[model samples]
Target: MGEEIGSDHFTQDDFREFGERLARETTLIRKLQDEGGLSDVGPVIGLELEAWLIDHNFFPAPHNQSFLARLGSEMVVAELSRFNIEINTPVEEIAGEGLARMHASISETMRQCASNAHDDVDTVIAIGTLPTLRETDMSLEMMTPSNRYAALNREAMRSRGGAPIVFDIDCCTGAGEDFTTSYQDVMAEAATTSLQLHLQLAADRMRAAYNASLLLSAPLVAISANSPLLFGKPLWHETRIPVFEQALAQPSPHQRVTFGSGYASLDLVEIFEENLELYPVMLPVCADAPDSDFKCLKLHNGTLWRWVRPLVGKSSDGKPHIRIEQRVMPAGPSVLDMMANAAFYFGVVEELAEYIDAATAEVPFEAARANFYAAARHGLGAEIEWFGKNRRRSVVSVLDDLLPMAERGLRRQGMAEHLIDKYLSTIAMRLASKQNGAAWQLAHLERHGDVHRLTADYLAHQKSGLPVHEWAI
Candidate 1:
């Protein structure tokens, strides 16, 4: 357990302003498992994609709340930024049809919102990071007004000791050896905007599914590296991971940026155990709320975890649901691309479960770890080190190996061929073409040379809703 470093007062429970929420969280997990059959595994596929709204002049539009209100809660919700909104659609795995189903559902959601947008001033664009985003844009004034958001922001400022939104990037390959990951972490975030995808896992399978997310992080990030420039400098393909990590870092006094102990173990208990030790709570339950499930603590302050932190929430029926929210993806080249990414992870988890004794036994967990770094560093260009019947292979080739595995896997699940192909094909095209969102962004910066112009161009492209592959520059 992360018993406070030195004489440090921080403890896992030190994160709470109130303890009832934790009690609710722990209790619900027990009930949901025992009575609800939530632990009885099956793929409950779905996705949540976040997008930013902009006006005709390509400026960030703060009207997203109003726009979303017009659209209603049946499909979307406003994000932290005024310019953003999120769309979620149910997930289904049918022999190869996963991508198409995910795509159609997301697209229709966008189209429905677009149809309602008025000529006076409103448009929605799906992109990795909005180039037009300015330091002033993410200021507290523009932050979405909500208790959770405000509480998170305030706690983040105090724990992090500064504002988290505006920052820079310096990849390991850069000249400065002492560069902090926090800088790149902040810049790599979803500034331009993106289509973030969320997939649900059965309660029992949470541990394996979460570890698979860490395993897929590299490739998922690399292939979709749309965010290259931070305030207009070249960096990682998809900078959102680092950016969000830092921005969401709770306001801590020290340099202890959250890194929940390297890669997660094969089980969720390991993550929870580590998280309970390393990461602190970032958001406290509403003070006046009646829900009282207490794991009492005195300090009442903890750090914020942006990506895969534990969440305690009351569902529509007023039952507690303990689920890990995967929040690192950017908006998309298309809804199909987003879903394909989902299938890659979701399918892989299923693969691990069905064949862990044989398949996972063959693949070195460390190699998978290496593959992750390679993916983050090289993306589709990375050489993943896989334990094959022959020898180790590059991530690119390994994926070349896995597409069929994915196909067979998806097919076994009764997924439609075309659906599987639609997304998997893009993964291949991304590798072969060597054209991902990051590469395209670097190329754009190479020519435009002006951050403002680059952002404007991004706005134009996204408004057109064309995939990075199809765009003509």
Candidate 2:
């Protein structure tokens, strides 16, 4: 979905042609899978951190048009809303200093973005959901000026048969009184931004990697929970979980950005098969690419925003490869925090993949999916089901038990011990303190600070280059 499209409008002929091409590509994918023809290029990792352009007052500043232009860098680009822009880092090999390199690259990009943040936009922030964001700010007028975004809004609205997009959520924060409110429009989706991590794996390992990612989603979201407040209401610990889904809600299952309907029984190609079967082509632009490109399949797959998305990419040599894009974590509180989150994911998923045989037998797909939502709703405070015990365990307990496994996984993968300890130790401290981004924000709110003050404090902590767990209220 990050790639640019040529046009917003498509003819019926376009859909038909796209469908024909998609079917051919899907078949090609299956043949490749059966023949073991997919690229064995990586365990290479990549990062995409989407952030907000805020004014000095901390309100979202719709100036990404000028801001991106001023940056004049391909690494930084506009998002669904003008107030948001995405910062991308080049893929780094998962070896010595790879995690540290990821952090350094992101920091450099942040500096570049800050250097070019036009006068109208104050600074770029990478947080789950901005506390100062108002319902009034979520209007069509705030959307980034792009054909793809316009077309997406149109198709999504059309999918709902022109019914208003509704965001009805009930939230209970122990410190604050529970609140429930409903919103209307796709712009609300713009309010939630995330830090998406991509790990390219060999085709043979795609299923194991994908399944492990799904199983780890709950504890991942719990420890990394950041979007606690939305529109000044204390919602779920990671409120963006529900907010983003409901903002783009449709009557059909295929159109929703989901945790997936079920686990993958086969290889990664099964995901594209499901996409071809269930999702109606939302952006059926006629493409002029080779059969190997699979533009039609790629575009359609992009529309289905699964938490852990299976993607097909071309290597430098133009051969096709597979990547598992992890979409569970939110963007900020800080760059080090984001890298720690990614390190924890890569390490745990690596270690957990070894247990896929046991996990598949012991853990049900439905339980894995439910655990994700439970964690998003309750953060580290959430209880999730693990493989050995039928009973649910606190997310904190889950992370504590898995920390050593992650360290061992990183070591086994040949990651530098210093880098491993530097990153995973942060996750360890977060588990010990039980104060992730969401917890920090909730604590501040409990200290009698208003949302505005909280946002300012968050930005200050974020700018200080300190992890959220160490940030004082």
Q: Model 1's lDDT to the true fold?
A: 0.55
True-vs-predicted CA distance for residue 19, candidate 2, Å: 0.8
**Model 1 lDDT tens row, 1-473:** 01111222334554454344544544544454557634333344556777877777666787766787777766687676667777777645444455576678887888887776765336777766666666556555666655545554555455556644444455632312222423312322336455444444555566666655555555566667666545445555665655665555444333233324444444443443343345455544334334323222111222334344444333433444434555455676655556666666555555645544344456556665566555655556676654447555665666666666666666667777666676677677766777776677667667667766766676566556555666555
Model 2: per-residue Cα lDDT at residue 364? 88
Candidate 2, poorest ten consecutive residues by summed lDDT: 175-184
RMSD for all candidates, in order, please.
6.5, 1.3
True lDDT of residue 16, candidate 1: 53
lDDT of 2 by residue, 1-473 (tens): 46779999989998999999999999998898889778887778999999999998889999999998888888888999989999999888887888788889999999888777567998888899999998889889998988889999999888888888666666756655555455445888887899999998777888898999999999999999999998777889999999888887889856568999777888889899999998898899868988788888888888888999999888755678878999999988888888888988898888898878688577788899999999999998898888876557887888998899889878877789998998999999988899999999988887866988999888888889998889988
CA lDDT scores, all candidates in order: 0.55, 0.86
TM-score of each: 0.77, 0.97
C-alpha lDDT of residue 151 in model 2: 91
lDDT of 2 at 83: 94
Instruction: Give the distance in Å from residue 467's predicted Cα in candidate 2 to where it truly belongs.
Output: 1.3
